[model samples]
Target: MTQTAKQAGHILIVDDNTDILIAAKLLLKKYYQKVHTTDNPFDIEEIVKTQPIDVILLDMNFSQDAISGKEGFYWLKKVVEQDPSIAVLLMTAYGDIQLAVDAIKAGAADFVAKPWQNDQLLGAVAAAYAHAQDKQKVGQLTRQTQGLNQALNQGAGGKNFDFLGQSAAMQQVFSTIEKAALTDANILITGESGTGKELAAHAIHQASLRRENALISLDMGAIADNLFESELFGHKKGAFTDAKADKVGRFELANEGSLFLDELGNLPLSQQTTLLAALQNRQVTPVGGNKAIDVNIRLICATNDNLQQAVDEGRFRQDLLYRINTIEIRLPPLRERSEDIPLLVNYYLEHFCHKYKRTLSVSDTDLQTLSAYAWPGNVRELAHAIERAVILSEGELLDISTVVGQVTTTAQPSQADSAQSESDQLVNADTFNLEELEHRTVRAALKHYQGNVSQAAKALGLTRGAMYRRLEKYDL
Candidate 1:
């Protein structure tokens, strides 16, 4: 998957008023990709079960004569019980501060009053989304670490360095990695993607005091927001709908080891705050479980983006930065450290040459030119280019264009752009599109069942999850 795909977030808004639902959808649709709004409180569970909703903006009262948020409490309890990872923000009167605080203690993530400013709503929603994402991540990694095969854990985390380069930049990086690894400090490595960030993280883990323990690595950017918690912290049997078995979380799995969270920037600000809390407390509770598990772990993080800039722009949390980044190690891009290009190219070339059974080699002139060419994708891109050249080599000499000259890239559409593109295709009534017909049939079944997602899914021979995704896709 592309990096952007890993950073996507979704939201859901629930209210009894159609106008409020419409306004919330319109305002939030700009910031979030999957925005779903429903006026019926009964439909909330079905929507949550079927959709990848990160957070919900819930109204406190559903009855016209209701003044107290008793109804809100009922639904909030249901929502929290449905998935403890999903953040619910209660919307109530400005004078309901006491009720709001009570709701928070009861598990409501945050409370926002009625007639809110755009920024206030945006900030709250943003935070809710981030919180859900963090919970999801910690849960996911925990589970993932638990399910990992023994061979996978030991394959390369401690054994590989491949981090070569004796340049001044290289010497400093090597020195920092060695010195920082001895201490249990939280180390944050920053550089462009493909600049060997993961390699550095793993190296740190290998050199650390926890090297005898498992060196668990996670790519924070590639994980989906919905599965984030399940993958990190784990879930109980029958947690939500899909979790069928009790599983261990990453923190528990990395209990006495080092946990390397790659692409730390990919984490949302909401998650950053919660992650900071968990790390500070050194404890995590499994989803759907009230008991907390204590863990002793060394933390290492890496990211491709400038975290300081993201914090300045308010896209990331500043306090969380201070927590994870106790000591910072900046990796110089390959272009800036051109002296290392030759070594990197030769390493990949030799490896690819043997794999493809080709006696091909790069000439001095071509190699020099390649070393001088700007590598926008960094070492990872260069390695890929070399592999491609080896596979397609015609003779003993590899083509220069195929050597670090060709890089792979992926383009993904923004949620808005994708929606616009899907809607842009005008459907002529004269023609019958089977896909359109299927969509209509699904919508009809869903409407007939009054948004009974399970019944509709059964009627359409689809799992409820599949049915919900379609509803989201067609904006039903």
Candidate 2:
């Protein structure tokens, strides 16, 4: 392996003896990429902040009659205070092992005695660098916690982030969210379109350890295949023709936060590999930059498509799927939780009524009609229906037909006469399961359209994606 790939870390050695600093720099340079020497401890904080130094080697006794290591302890305290993530390693004589131990207890990560073995010094430095990496992650998390507290306390749009559902299925989903929020694990939210997958993802982020950070959401479906990398990992100035300046990618912007990957199944196969690599490495190099900056983010991905089926079809990478699907929360569609329809209707009714400055309410009889119908578009459609109804309502009692017309008029097949005829035929014919009737309807639509997916999807009142998924489920 190349030196750059084989070894990593920036080492800084600070000591009173210039020779010791030079010697330590020479020894550690072979094992690490960057090494710098300094004879002054007063500039320790400046050096640490100015440079991305992973480990620092410090001397216990600086000036004459400093054998007690008082100055060293003071410097160590300063270094630790400046950035505890930078592992501080003390260098002392064999007789000062006691002082070194005291320094270690005071926050120094490790210590190496003078006249150390080549192997011993290298091992200590390597271990210290490892510790620095872990501490860096902890530091990020700590900052995120502080920021989250501020946001929640300040009421930063927390009220608008409405997540309401109390059915058994929804309760289970909420339970999963609570359990998974505090950890660094990746989450995959699966549901049909309009089932509030994105809302659930936001809820998890709000509840997570990374909640203080902004939840950076990327709609993989909306992003073009060619611009995928530049969108996620970013590019440096002049990296490409349109590259204007150094732009921070979503990953960087979401540092110490949560990253929500919406419509994750729509991401192309090629970008899937790149995404998997970044998640595995926990680092990214800009398009024109060589140094990989470490990132700490909680990943929450949502998809309406079946990722496992996509993997089987070679449309998605199985490894990438596995990485993001550490904790899968499958959200049930609105049809399964019919009990929540009245509650949802009232909630949206009040929200839209307040916004539109209209006093409106849905009658129980009209709500029953809404609850009885199958909401193919789920809660999102229900919300729209209420909003449109509230806007159109001329009286306090909502016009139920006006509210129901949105879905029925926009999605139903144009052949209204034939649909009515078929409904009458079904009513007069033998009893049939609703699921079977739905399957037959979809299959008949496809046949009528001569297997044209676009026409079939339109006629069947489904998005191409949802129709395509149902087709696979029924092997049609």
Candidate 3:
């Protein structure tokens, strides 16, 4: 690497001889941005705590005629204990093969002999700095992965869903996602609602070179326009009324990994301008901060809306579309891939059966019934149907009677028709208990929509959370 390229690294030299310390710092400072030196080993801890030192060069002997390398071993342990990611190189004039092996075994990064050639010393320091950087990246990636996993589990209720398909249309999607994962180019996934767009994003991330790092996914449709900049670029403490503390934005959190932005077409023209600038510059400035932070993330965006139509209609920016869609992956809706329905149904059935602790088997007739239905909610709808069936059906052979309903309506019907139908169905009820009435209503809604939660919630004038609560409260 060029000296300018290595300017971000910091080096520390610890030696008993002032001459050695000065010479080393003078030569290294020209290449590295920061160079520290101290003769007393006692000051190592304080320097380490205060400065972001990437590599340390230490002398094995601290006293005259001292060559056993015991002092070097002691400080090496101390430095590593303080920060395991920092690389430490041990040096001694009386070095031997045994001492080198011992130093390495004691956590020293490398061994250097005293009176080393200038080129040799520089190469050692450079190698040590690179090692430190790798360790730092690994450590940061681990912490970010843990945080992202926790966030996903909490937000998605720990749903474990994967893309499963064998039809022609789906094979094409799989091919495109695989090709996209081989590069760092930005990707745009387009499909109808509930067509597993997010699942495609996850597949790309898992297959990509950045798989070891966290894949940060955000729903662009859920972000309010006013909070768009603060959410994507972050904000400092006291930046605004609700800015309680310094927050890292999604872009920063996804550095050196992948950032999946769902519902990109829902982004307004005004906010598109800000997002465009960040992607173009590869950096983001916090709301109240002047310095911009550089980020390296593979961009993956999904949208059900027609971005091309939106751009032509003057809703989306043409330049932003060009920036995001270096590669476009269009997922076929469930209806277009009906041949894969049986496979999806069986997978979900097995999963939900295991989850709900039931021994059940689906009949060929039931599978055929499911395969024929027009699933407006796609695979998500199919999975929910199977889960509900597993929970509600009794006595073996998978009762899908509750999963089949009349002509599927994408939206809620008029209030008159809904109330009249509900009343007629309730006219034969045996009890007047409010709880019992609510349970029956929830069950009917689920049945009417074939286990589609969003539609059922809308039909009952309840949020999805309320619908879920009813399902759990009555164990239906």
Candidate 4:
């Protein structure tokens, strides 16, 4: 019998025996807000279709013509088909225990036997209702999680980047960013090209106090050298031949927000003086104008060049470097964290599958090839390769042919080696001896591989036994 109360639920009881239905309805009236019963199994369908049935108590056996429990099974499937989330409790006699268990396997929430105790019946109904509610909640949460994942995937163009790794180099980068986000000082991000310096800038900005405001960005290298002053500090009407109206500079636009200056090393020496003045004074005087505009903006600058060397050569201002380098964040190239490549690949594969409305899976061989190659362009280049593969995919699974074209288009050995030599000179300047630099390189490689002798040896172009002897000699 269903229990009656101010907040009691509506219940529907289905059985073929009139006496049993009347008795059940009488007992349920004391606990339920509404108790509807039907003696004919056929009438149960119409009652459910037209009424608000919160719980359905179904009899395992109906009339004699309904043998083998076929009718009962049909109605159970129908009810679930109509509302998969609705709770259904099966009713069976002691002799039909097997049928009750079968009904549960077929999706019944629970079961109660005939001639049951009043307390037991009420308990079963309560449990079934709770289970149904839990199922609904989980379903809603699953949909919401999927929606968020889809939105992020679409925003990233179906590519996922792994910003977390276990290497010591990555750990240092993570710690620096975390510490830097807590302060208001200007940050100077230094790293080789394609080493995710911009990503670090974004991460710091997103984690800072002024995260709500827009992060304005300007690539100093992309702008023309002659127009650098006007672009950074704005210009008044007729300030130059092309200047027709007054315009706000990046500093003014980024007020109360963050301004990310990329390729800062490329800015001419004259422009660096102006940038230094702006930072020291917290104000800017537009070209062809006398009034200075005050701004409260955080500065995050990135460069792949050695600014210290530029200062020594009289190409960059020492004063400007001191102002912008209050805090420094350095990022290692992708080759240093190659173990994270497989994780990033799987994430991107799932993302692309959902984005392109295609079901494609990646193979182990594909992952091996990607991890083996040197990513000179780093994560950005890897993302393009995956996108190209997805576009060329023709079946449910990605084939090797889909990636051949992209691999061929990447930087060749001769070009990459030349670039590496130039990059090393630019990054290191002339601060250290060759032998000392070699020791540091070997140590960094060993640390990156977690002291793995074979891996570090391969990375440093040395035999395993030779690397072990050097490690002992250097006491690394």
Candidate 5:
């Protein structure tokens, strides 16, 4: 095969015979990206250290009548000690078959005798290069898996309420997850931004047959447009400007496990086709890599958007939606299941109290007040609110003000104030100063949304930037 048709690598040749070094370099350089030869056996370590050598060709007899091959064995040990993953090919002038068998037993990849045919030399080098690549890839995979497992454990620590609810809505969700976890079907979880979609994914993976394997989670919305392919399918070294090393993609890392794609609805239509193709084919070809790697994964996707509506608007691919939604599960928002609020609140309260080493209690009145409020941001907002309350509390009672900020009377005006409409109440303030009224209105909007700037801005008919400016102007 031609050089372009073959899988190329970096070759290092170390031999005391200058003629042998010259001949090997001339022949191998035609097929490999790099071929470095040295006549001094002592320079092996320096050369290997400086270059990304995939395979090393060492002379079995460095000195004349050095047929015992002790020098070759010494250099071979040095090479292996430097990197056990590197392949070392032993070459000798003495054609001793027993010596070849001995070299194989001593960690040498292969042994080549002198007067070797050109084709035989090329085949041996190619085999050694392939061995080195395989060994390096396996090492990288093991390290990556360990790192991924560590992250997964840290993330799981916060998911204590994965199945902590007693409401009918949550019970149904648990039932569906239990049934789906038994099969190898693709699952799509639809919920508001903070309804615990990621936790649901974790629950499914933990209960499934692939629980022992990795559960790779990727936030689709967080990835940049240019990096979508490389992040999901992986990239080889030198594939792009920033690709300095080979990457194992989420799909490959989650092989025979689960791959959770969060915020999948935020993915643009242009990139949806690429993801769809990989799912349909069960294979991913890394950037700058010629061969395709097969992946066996159970797909789990979560999104806050109404994907069917997105498909109707031509913003999301219909086929892709169909592929991911083989088994759909929708989580009810906090507002929809108001009764479950107390359970979530108590859970987070205990969790935060233990975490912060504080003693705090929530009264029934406070629980009622919390349940009555419409939590637009859902469970995630409530979680932050409780944690904020715990950390900022100095007394035995949980400080609700620190959690939700100052509550404006606009949400629940007194009987006398109820007679006046919201706009009338604002206009009839003691002072008609526009500045004072504007500040009060801004503060109220912020408190009503529980500090959600976007929702507050939308409620007051202002853009996000305009809202930010107002907050800056009022210093609120």
Candidate 6:
């Protein structure tokens, strides 16, 4: 039978017998690229320290006079202390089988009899090598999983929300959430559209003491002015035109839990007055009902618009804002925290790759371009981009060109102009031809650097040679 040599593995064999060492070396040489042999148990530590050893095959009886396996036991403990990941296999004569089994309990991976068969020895070695490799892989995966979970736990809680950031801005937000979690006060989350305000509200709910209960969410924008009172407070049967049966509102459902009121700034004046009354009284009076119901609930409100500005315009109630803003958490725009782009991109890339079962890797250059682009839609937009890229990816690595192609057509021209312009210009479809505009922008970058290729290349996130070739193709 032909034996397949295990590639790129190092094995250490420690035995007191010179004949056994020679025989084992000859047999193991075919399986491993590097094999180190030591006849003295004391030299095992030195060999491990100087060499990259994956597995240690130690003999149970190291000394002729000492048959109690004391030397092997002592060395086994030392080897494990030095590197916990190293796999160890113990060997003993047929009479000393009990001693070999005891060594296994002391951390040895497996045991082999002294009169070992070739297949048995080879199988043990192969299994030990595989086990060690698996340990290393699991360790790496554990670290990555912990990192992602910690990041998610630190962000605002909500359904299917992704915590996307590694920037100082995000760090500050995380620290604020950690501090806010210690209190039981009402929280107000403020941010621009698509800034994950709802997510932050969810985070507060998850981190709060009342997390066991449900987190009921109500979109103030989605509730009609006529249905506002019934939505905030439950209604008895025959309350309105659509009322066929008694219904429970968000306030009642979120009793002892968190009530997330999204787009709070959009709530009509009439609803705000009723909401303020409910907050101050710690109770609710259902529409078309005379009885008052007492409830204990934590209120968390989120909004993209400025409530203070709305209050000035007499559109939003100031008293309601004060009640909700007892503690406020503001999420900065993705452009303000550009450092988090790559981390968020990788997070979404991994998520989508797994979702699609695709093997895809992002190149450093592709990541740079993604980081430079201003994500108007924030983390949500970036996730969509990565998902699209994963779907379009043809090979082992994601093709940036394919991503760019999809992005160029759907991407608003104003967004690209806003990214390139010195001022904050809103990008709309009326701005420019995206393909021609992208080509022109690249040409402008090349001209600005005076053909000082590297500088121009850096501005456009392209290699110097690649930029020069593109310039030639465009006839610039």
List per-prediction Cα lDDT, in the order shown.
0.74, 0.76, 0.80, 0.71, 0.80, 0.73
Better of 4 and 5 by TM-score: 5
TM-score for all models, in order of appearance: 0.54, 0.60, 0.60, 0.52, 0.65, 0.53
For lDDT, candidate 1 versus 4, the one ahead is: 1
The CA-based lDDT of model 6 is what? 0.73
Candidate 2 on 148-253: residue-level lDDT in tens?
A: 4543565533236378898999999999999998898899998876678888888998898777668877777666677787777766666788898655566766
Q: What is the RMSD, in Å, between candidate 2 and the native fold over all Cα?
A: 12.1
lDDT winner between 5 and 6, please give it.
5
Give candidate 4 regions above 4 Å deviation.
1-166, 404-476
Question: In lDDT terms, how accurate is model 2?
Answer: 0.76
Q: How many backbone clashes does candidate 5 have?
A: 0
Q: Which candidate is the best by TM-score?
A: 5
lDDT of 3: 0.80
Model 1 agreement with the true structure over 351-404: per-residue lDDT tens digits:
888777888888887777777665545676677778788887787898867444
Off by over 4 Å in 6: 1-158, 400-476
Q: What is the lDDT of residue 141 in candidate 6?
A: 48
Model 3 spans with C-alpha error above 4 angstroms: 1-153, 156-159, 406-476
Clashing pairs in 4: 2-28, 3-31, 3-32, 4-30, 4-31, 4-32
* Candidate 5, 328-355: lDDT as tens digits: 9999977678789999999899989999
Per-residue lDDT tens digits for candidate 4, residues 294-406, read 77899999986778987998978999999888998877766777777776677667766677777878778777767766665566556556666777888767764655433
Worst 10 residues of 2 by lDDT: 406-415
- List of clashing residue pairs for candidate 3: none
- Candidate 1: lDDT of 413? 39
